[model samples]
Target: MSLTDIINAVVSLKKDEVVENVISEINKGTQVDDILDKGLIESMDVVGAKFSSGELFVPEMLMAAKAMQAGLEVLKPHLSGDATAEKGTVLIGTVKGDLHDIGKNLVSMMVEGAGFNVIDLGVDVDVEQFVTQAQTQNADVVCLSALLTTTMPVMAKTVEAIKEAGLKVKTIIGGAPVTEAYAHQIGADGFSDNAPGAVELIRKLMAA
Candidate 1:
């Protein structure tokens, strides 16, 4: 089957079918990166667009992400170092006192699908935790999520802490209560309103 066939399967949320197709392609000597980029990652881009356009909802996005992950499992081992050479590492989490995580989880999945190595720190992560992890992991980007307005200041503090520590990582903030202006005021390198946009923002920040 063509790579687009696999892409279609992922978009349709056929998890088993996506896994089978990925394995089949690998068996046929298809380049692993090609399968990941053309099939699975591309499918996520489409899914993201559908989500942003309101053509799909959270349940659908989650299913598509699951399908992509299923295919990723089959391809991971075969992906050599060179295949991941262009990918950057990201550390993501919701700020301290913010137990909300749906948005953060979505960003994690989408960023992973975009070929970045993601370390999800989970919800209620403190600034010290964020700074420590980013330093330890040598992450290229630090993403903070805050759903509550009260937690917004915590995100700012987290950004400030990372900067003050002289960590060589770009910071991005997002959530229902976050805005680009807020991100800039807090010294965040960037911000995005949705999961897909977050991936793009990270890409730009890394490239810069």
Candidate 2:
């Protein structure tokens, strides 16, 4: 499939075709990060815009994320096994009391697609878990996600744990219930509204 076809299939959530095409590109020696950034991530950016504009809904975003993950599975082996290329490490997870995983999964996939080596701590993760993983992995960034209005406190607690440790790690927070204001109020280093933007925002955090 063409690169554009692969991108659209991901954005539109055309499942099987997206996976098949990403592999095709990989076999052709296309750079994995390019396929992700120029292709899959760009498509997700559109998906996010559609979500904001009401042209797409949660179900569509989930399906598109599924397609993105499929593509990532095909490209991951080639992208992350090198040493000279320092993409930085990030520890990520959904905070406790938030069982909603669709958003968490998309953020994980998009972060991997953005070229960082990510450690996913899974859903319902607690504050101690976030700090422990960040410490264990020497993570460059710590990301906490929450889907409910009530779980925002968990994000704050997670960041607090890292801050208390006196680590140099940057913290990022995101979810439907999260905003830049709330992120700042909670002392998060950055905030993003969607998966692609989250990935880009994390990149910016790491760069600084």
Q: Evaluated with lDDT, which candidate comes out highest?
A: 1
Model 1 accuracy (lDDT, Cα) = 0.86
Error of 1 at 184 (Å): 1.2
What's the distance in Å from true for residue 76, model 2?
11
Give the per-residue lDDT of model 1 (tens digit) for 61-143.
88988888888767766654322554989999998998767668767877887788999999999989999999999999999
TM-score per prediction, in order, is 0.61, 0.63
lDDT for position 170 in model 1: 95
lDDT of 2 by residue, 150-171 (tens): 9999998888888999989999
Would you list the C-alpha lDDT of every candidate in the order shown?
Answer: 0.86, 0.81
